[model samples]
Target: MIATTSLQRMIGALAALLAAVGSASAHPHVFAEARLDVVLSADHQSVKALRHLWRFDELFSSTVLMQFDKNSDLKLDDAELKDVADTIFSSLAEYDYFQLVTVDGKDVHMNAPSQVMTNFDNDQLIVLFESEPATPIKLAGTIDFGVYDPTFYTAIDFTEDANMAVEGLPSTCTRKVIRPDPDTAIAQNQKTLTDAFFNDPTGTDMSKIFATKLELTCKP
Candidate 1:
């Protein structure tokens, strides 16, 4: 017969092992091609985000929202939300070819629900903050090639050319727009295209046209 204390210890050990296994299983390690579109408020107050609009060969069944902070350690406050918005907007403006224009010569603040939906896959997602009302901001661009494998690492190589039209912002504040050089752009496009051939669901390898471009548009 087994001692009661020994049985209890065995149960606890089993539980711990199960937990570790579950955590490992939760992460999917397969890589797939993806693209993302991120929009930001003119005053750097919030962001309107989108993703996975243009898939080269339809490798994924549905778009899944990979939690930005999978560990749940990073919580968003009012100030943090604004900071995130500013970071995204500024990053796009500096690294990509994007235009920021004032709307009707007014600084408009806006708000929306915490959650937003995608039209292509009907995927429901939550944004950390809402867009302020009366503030209209728009972003348009494209990402060429990227990969997201939950179990491993998410790697993406792409360029975006966006135009941000803001309702109320100072004219003196100018946003910079940057784009990739020809060689890097071509390489990213080719890598993305090649990856699709191997991972696409159809199992038939298809040659992607490196010259093709993807476009994204956001309106709020």
Candidate 2:
């Protein structure tokens, strides 16, 4: 009877040990989705222009800033600015990530609007633009953003020399086990993992992730 009792105790101890170990290796799940809207002007000039407004809401375990800094220190010379602008404009024109198309036989171009301060006096940059002259402009597309959570593993190790004497344990049971719960670890480390993920890849691909809608304007 004593032998059976000892075996049951051992089994229970082993189960507990395994459970503790397993708890330290779990991961969190995450996802994201977004919406966009584009509007065009009524004036149907050959070079018609309209406004493109993008509204994005992130659905995830945490909130992430889309713009890293309002005042970027990366200074650009005129050439550099032109290059950047050209690249951005061309990308918007050709890239599938953006919902961009010619409206009223007029080629649409993305333009930087003047900065404006809100009621709170916070300066904000406009990311959308419309072409000049009243042209028959049509709405282009929308973009969706998404990402998955990254996994992290942490282990606690105790050297044999660090082992303290336990009154009841045999010398063979020398190893000290230490670990943290996976959920707790994930909750603690998710921000760091998310930052790294975004840092590596950068912006969402617009073409495959975007859609479009269009309507006509009655006024000039």
TM-score top scorer = 2
Query: Candidate 2: RMSD over Cα atoms?
Result: 27.8
Q: Model 1: residues >4 Å from true position, as ranges?
A: 1-57, 61-113, 121-152, 155-158, 163-168, 178-220
Error of 1 at 199 (Å): 33
Model 1 has an lDDT value of 0.30
lDDT of each: 0.30, 0.27
- Decoy 2 TM-score against native: 0.24
lDDT of 2 by residue, 1-220 (tens): 1232322222111222223435322322222122222222333222233333322222211111112212443333344334333433443342322333333434344443332111101122113333333333332321111111112111111122122111222222222322335466557767764665577532222211111122222222
Clashes of each: 16, 16
